[model samples]
Target: MAGLKKKMTIPFARVPVAINEQKYVQEVLESGWLTTASKAAALEKKFARVVQAKYACAVNSGTAALHLGLEALGVKPGDRVFVPSMTFTASAEIIRYLQADPVFLDTEYGTNLITPGILEEAIALHPDVRFLIVVHYGGQAAPMVSDENQAGILEICNKYGIKVLEDAAHAFPARLGERMVGSLGDVTCFSFYANKPLTTGEGGMLTTRNKEIYDRVKKMRLHGIDHDVWDRFTENKPSWEYDVVEAGYKYNMPDVNAAIGLAQLEMAAEFRAERQRAAMFYYEHLGQLQEFMDLPVTRVPFSDHAWHLFPVVLKEKAPLGRNEFIKKMAMAGIGTSVHYKPLHRMTYYKNRYHLDAKSFPRAEKTWQGNVSLPIFPYMTPEELNYICKTIEKLLKY
Candidate 1:
């Protein structure tokens, strides 16, 4: 052990900071108004403008945003909703929150996305399904509108009168064609968790063009209060006269988190560029290893993808299985994660719904090999080299 070299550590994610992060956060602390206030309100306005949506409501988490979005869409008990089995649990669990049943559908193989074709098939099977939650998987925006010759998800949903709620947890600042993901669907929810493209410590935003839906979410996000606490306190009339219009959850984003979000929002484009740079580096170095592993696929330009995660799929011909590959990467001081194990494979969904793994062929197959690599803003060239080289050394056998 005399001259053994120390291994270099590369984390699965590193939160990138903007110039104003601390400055804005300090101002919020000094103001003594930390709960949902002016800061949160300002964030909503700026976020709406950035995503090109008519209205935005900041909430405590992406899951809260999803719940509110679905509630605003009028999802009720006994309603059947279409959701992809490939995404995070929140996409499907929120349906259960409303006492609705989730009819999980399979995603496309390479992209791990619910395509228009998949939607059509699911709709035919469940003719009464009137709601859909489409996830923009791993920063790549799913096509919500039709392109030249192909019908998009929105078009297919429209044909069946299904309401679409976009779960854009990994897709802040992502686009389809010229439009941002938040503005593409009936309602879109974005996350600002510490590791998301934009970090707010813990927060989310719901965006929509519909005034009715916007108004409903706003009122319902905070115990169904007719007026916001900030509005009541700042206005001359009275601070404690607001009425609870209906039962709602306590899911308001604090001013402290909003302060961080405001700063992060200002630097979103720069953060996205750095993440894309890291993604491109992986593609350049790992392109040759496709015979053993499959790189992420996207229909849009690389710049249009937010690159929140750089996930690879190991093939049967790989030198090792997914778990062994991840273990080897960790041993080499590189952190990695499995994007998902698939909802159909989870005990709760599997047992409760009697889900068969065979039903979600694409998701099950993808899950078997899916491993999310280290991709983050400001990843150094040396660090990138180490990661890719480590992967090649492990898989080239």
Candidate 2:
């Protein structure tokens, strides 16, 4: 057995920063246009092209993108939105922000994403569902389009006048049968947070094919202004006049952040390849521990994974409990995280929605055993080997 490292620290994620990231940011700083200006606009254009979406709007965070997308989808107070309980709180919290209610759905066993069967069941139970937020869990694209039936999630939702919004926080560059996630639904939200596949310090983007939604999001993203703030200063005539079309939030991505995003977007393909390599490394090595742990699904039907996270689930037969295993890894200077704790299991959501563990059997069980290992694009081979060997050693203890 390889000896444990006396001291080392592998972070859960180290945000990817490209060589040009600093150059673009420096240009933005010297230009003195700090708000959502040229770089932000450039990022929006570049991201839309990359994701094959007709329109893209950059926002301050993934949560902002969801909130704005929901508002544009015509989600109203008291409306019922179907959301997966296994996602981060941001996915469902937006429903509450609009004074609407969330009908939490359980995840599919293998993919850990909300499947069509579960969606159908939720529809059967809550026929009044007007909106749905499908999160591509663990960077694996959820089956938005189905082969089982002609009517996929979008088609079914359209049939009943239910709008679909995709929370693609973990699924940037992920695809479903030639269609990228950003173009898969009515409006798809992508996170550019430090830990996501792409990072802009703190930013996100909303993509869509609907021109109306795009226009609304653009106007509403920055305090409902009729014209972009940049237009006032950047124009040859320098017009300062503008109108607030409606009450909106301050959710515009700054030039500095967007500069970083533009660089990140440019290097997305390379970053994805590296991350995928890391995922493959884990998959190949972790298979030997199947009796002790269950690894994430690397492949999904009709979809390509972005490999943003590598989550492992400890089985009942494991030598250590989930928490115990995490502690042991920490002692070896390795960091780990739980992708989620199932929103329904959280105190705020559970108490408010009258949810119990029994409400979502799969998600509850998955939560109990879930542990996310480091799988960033920059992770070294030595780091990967150390992680795997450490797990092997921990299992024996």
Cα lDDT of all candidates, in order? 0.91, 0.87
Q: Where does model 2 exceed 4 Å of error?
A: 1-7, 148-151, 234-238, 299-303
User: Scored by Cα lDDT, where does model 1 land?
Assistant: 0.91
On residues 292-321, what C-alpha lDDT tens digit does candidate 1 reach at each position? 999999878998999998889999999799
lDDT of 2 by residue, 208-325 (tens): 9999999999888989988787867677645778888899889999999999998888888888888888988888887899999988865464237888888889988998889988
Q: Residue 103 in candidate 2 has what lDDT?
A: 89
User: Deviation in angstroms for 247 in model 1?
Assistant: 0.6
lDDT of 2 at 127: 88
RMSD of each: 1.9, 1.9
lDDT of 2: 0.87
Off by over 4 Å in 1: 1-6
